[model samples]
Target: MISIWIYATLFLGFMVLAARSDARDLRISNRLTLTMAASGLAAVGLLGGGAAALLVAAATGAATLAIAWVLFEFGWLGGGDVKLAGAAAIWLGPEATLAFVLATTVFGAVLAVLLLVLSRWDMMLEMVGSHWRTRLTADTISVPYALAMAPAGVLAILARFPDLF
Candidate 1:
């Protein structure tokens, strides 16, 4: 149980860092995604249900990847976002995966609204830094949806390790 807590903490920490990076650079590193996926597998294995967990994780990841690929083809999401979401889904499993998706969808909408409002104010945009200002103001830039992804991942982790509260 304690080990699970530790794993959950680590997972949440990395997720927060990924969200920060995505917010700042619009990119989620493959290294971070891989680490998250590995940690999730390790944690699941520790639960004494390694085989079933692995299968569930694999299936969830494949499903997420398929959905993400379609979204990517439609130019709605970036490759990094796809990879990050798929990796996180391995941790979330089937039960909580739907919650993660719903959470991400809600947060994405909120982020879009906030960015839209921020883009309207020159002073606010300038304060966000030149790179972000340009992206926020650009007509074609994609939102760093990983910000929402991280929070959803954390929520799913919390659902699994409820006692962490």
Candidate 2:
């Protein structure tokens, strides 16, 4: 359907853009984030269901952003991760977004536990390194945490709603 097509386009485009943002010479700013945020929400609105559905997505998305902010404030998250969380909210709605967050949390926790069992906390620490109480330099950072998981969540939802993209 048209919705699926749009969602597919948006998903692919977002991934490409995000990846591009990760390039060595690229520079991301708040303006770019806002533009992407708008587009990302629109994609969710059109692809997920409708305006009504988007309303749900918005609420859920806000919750996701709020939680991310809290974590970020505690030096537990990155700005990019917060932005990704908000972007996902625009499409997933609250319930779906919650599902995404829960899934990501479980995934991350499992990964962490696995790392610990393997005695690789030091490696895991390297990613966020000595920043549990403060942020690292903005340069040379990976993409946001939510971004890594958002696609998986969206894909799972799309699987359930075959009509969606």
Candidate 3:
């Protein structure tokens, strides 16, 4: 039980940090993603979920990375986003990983649309700080995808560990 709380706390804390960093800089640090993945494996072991569970989680994470790599290759997702998604999948395990991917896709689409609408409003962009103004008004329109990923990740976590609530 204690291990579950620790696992949840670690996952949530790292996710929040990743979201903030991605939003601010449009980048998720490799260090943060690596730590998140490593900690998730550690948490699984601590939970006595057994070697099978750990292997499943690892395989899920690997599959996610491979898919995300293809997305990156197609120029659909940034490298940081790929790494972050893969790391998140490890925490989500096999079943919840599917939910995370689906939810993240939906959230990403919504976020992109919202950003496009908001960007059209010059006043709205100006009201925010210069840094945000630049981010929102950029011609390229890079979505801070981790913002979308974070909420979906939280939902996945809750779904995977409903007893925690």
lDDT per residue as tens, model 3, 89-160: 888888888889999999999999988988899878878788878877888788888898999888888888
Best by TM-score: 3
Better candidate number, 1 or 3, judged by TM-score:
3
Say what the RMSD of model 2 is.
6.4
lDDT of each: 0.81, 0.57, 0.87
Task: Supply the global lDDT for candidate 2.
Answer: 0.57
**In angstroms, how far off is 110's CA in candidate 1?**
0.3
Instruction: Estimate, for each residue in 2-29, the C-alpha lDDT of model 1 and write its tens digit.
Output: 2776777777787788889898888889
Count of clashes, each model: 0, 4, 0
- In model 1, where is the ten-residue run with the lowest total lDDT? 1-10
lDDT of 2 by residue, 1-165 (tens): 246666656654654465356332223345555766687667765564667766766677677788889987987566766776677556555555666677767655664454344343445456653443122233333323444454556554564356762
Q: How close is every model to the real structure, measured as TM-score?
A: 0.90, 0.60, 0.94
Off by over 4 Å in 2: 19-29, 44-51, 106-147, 150-156, 159-165
